[model samples]
Target: MKVVVGIPSFNNAETISHVAKVAAKGIMEFFDGDGMIVNSDGGSSDGTRERFMETDTFGVPKESFVYEGIPGKGSAMKAIMEFSLEQGAQTVVFLDSDLRSVKPWWVERLAGPILRGEADYVTPFYLRHRFDGTITNNVCFPMTSALYGKKVRQPIGGDFGVGKKLLEIYLEKPEETWKTDVARFGIDIWMTTTAINESGRILQAALGTKIHDVKDPGKHLKGMFLQVVGTLFELMVTYQNRWMSVWNIEDVPIYGETPEEEIPPMTIDVDNLKKLAKETLVVPEYVNESAVREVKEDGTLSLNSWVDLLYRSAVQYRKTRDKTVVENLLPFYFARTARFAEEVKSLSDEEAERYVYEQLGVFLERKRLLKEEWEVEDKG
Candidate 1:
């Protein structure tokens, strides 16, 4: 099959060269002379453009590289899809720009199932560091599995492989299938979800090693949570009828049972939890303005307003749980505001940092307990 590897890059100058060379090598090894590598960049300020222009030691010709206009990851992927179709590529494999542990066989593994017609979409599974988006596994994976009735282990995994037919379907229904959060973290989740819902065949492949840089667990939790879970929830609600059909399929698998593998251990910092809680408290302001509207004569928040905010947040975050989790967690909605208010009221400017840290310890411990309960339910 004619295979084209697309790398969606931003300001990835520091690591682009290595990623390109390794990916190029993988393509050449797997598909022989029929494989090509393309990088669709999002107008990087760094010398990424110039770097791609430079010579590559990987025997693949430099003419195979093309840089497109500024757009989100989805746009970049769209560009690559157009290019791959134009070039008559039968399959497309996408690798992230930030991959640090890519092996020579990575591309082969991702595309193997698709090339053989065993799966329509393939995602990577790897050993990640403790702080690497573990919340994705805890929250996103189960929600996707339960809702869609497919065992897509890495629903938000950046690397993926897709057949030409699937790519055409994706392009045909861009608004419905394409992800809007292309620049940040939402693109991957969008693709995975779309594949599961549209393509009956989807599978996860073991990458056998961790890839990409280690991220600060707490630093990105809120943003990651908001983008991934938020988008998922919206999709779930919007496509409720479709998902209900998927859920009712008795033969469908609800969980991935491919042997328990060891993943990197993550530690939740108390300070980070408090910071996230405080940050989440800001949702009401945005919600009140965007998702929630004041009704009646008074300007006070109405019940519909509260429900709208909750729905919007849950939709945007893709928080998947039974109705019970939603009801139980609804109470914590006000607690978020109260925590922020308490932080502001009790702590002086000089003491605020320390106070938050102290409060975070208690908050995270509570989170741990809640998580334990969720885990019990998940396993049971």
Candidate 2:
């Protein structure tokens, strides 16, 4: 079967060469060099394209394309998809350019399931620092798990593999439906969610330790946060019927070994996040100001507080059909993360996972409230 490895890059001059070389090695070693490395760039000005092309491919075919139309990882991925389709590739695997710890095993392990017809899609199951991927730890993972009843740990993890059938189905989606966030940071979650909804065979491949350019949610740009969370909300609305009927949560089949190396825990900059939230917060007139005061004064927020916030906000967004309503929930999101980070700073991964799992129960418990809010959605 023809295999294609896709790397979506932007300003990745620091790490692109290493990632590309390892990926090429995986393809050459495992697939007998029958595959090609397609580097799809988002017009990186840091000479990322040059560095990627300069990387030794060990006789494997390599091509690089820079998108002049729109600048986003999703755009690059779309180009890669088109390229793979034209090449008649049966399996396509993607990895982010910033992955410093990705090994050759990652490529074959992620794509193997697809190539062998064992699975239609594969997601990376990375051994990351407990504090890394805060959004996934707190929101995306739990929300996706609760909704779909599948504990596919990283629904939005950037690295994954998909087959031609899945690729064709994705390409058939209306451009307007995904041209926004899905065209950017929302791409991973969008694909994962759609895959789950379609009942495709999805597998999680172990990727050892995923050490990459970790972004501190608090100090990082809000564009991605908004886009990811916004896309998540949109998907929830679109798949409400399916998730609403989900009665139990289950685990997906995992196909790799956990890393044995002792990974040091990542730290959270709570003080900086506190400062950022205070500086950037623009409270909507509809939020409960008193609850905001309580969170600000002591960094203490309850489960009900989050449920109420989500419930009311989801209602408002559904009613108004305005993105501002969904975006307005970001402040509370920031506050909640800040507080939770402090709580889990000293905790182990097992401890942290327990905390998040319990918290997800609260979300399920209060989902009826969201249903109630939906019933009386204010169109005013």
Query: Candidate 1 on 75-108: residue-level lDDT in tens?
Result: 7887888888888888888988888777667887
For model 1, the superposed segments whose C-alpha errors exceed 4 Å read 55-57, 62-70, 174-179, 182-184, 246-268, 278-380
Error of 1 at 68 (Å): 6.2
Residue-pair clashes per candidate: 11, 0
**Clashes, model 1:** 11
Q: Name the best candidate (by lDDT).
A: 2
RMSD of each: 11.4, 2.1
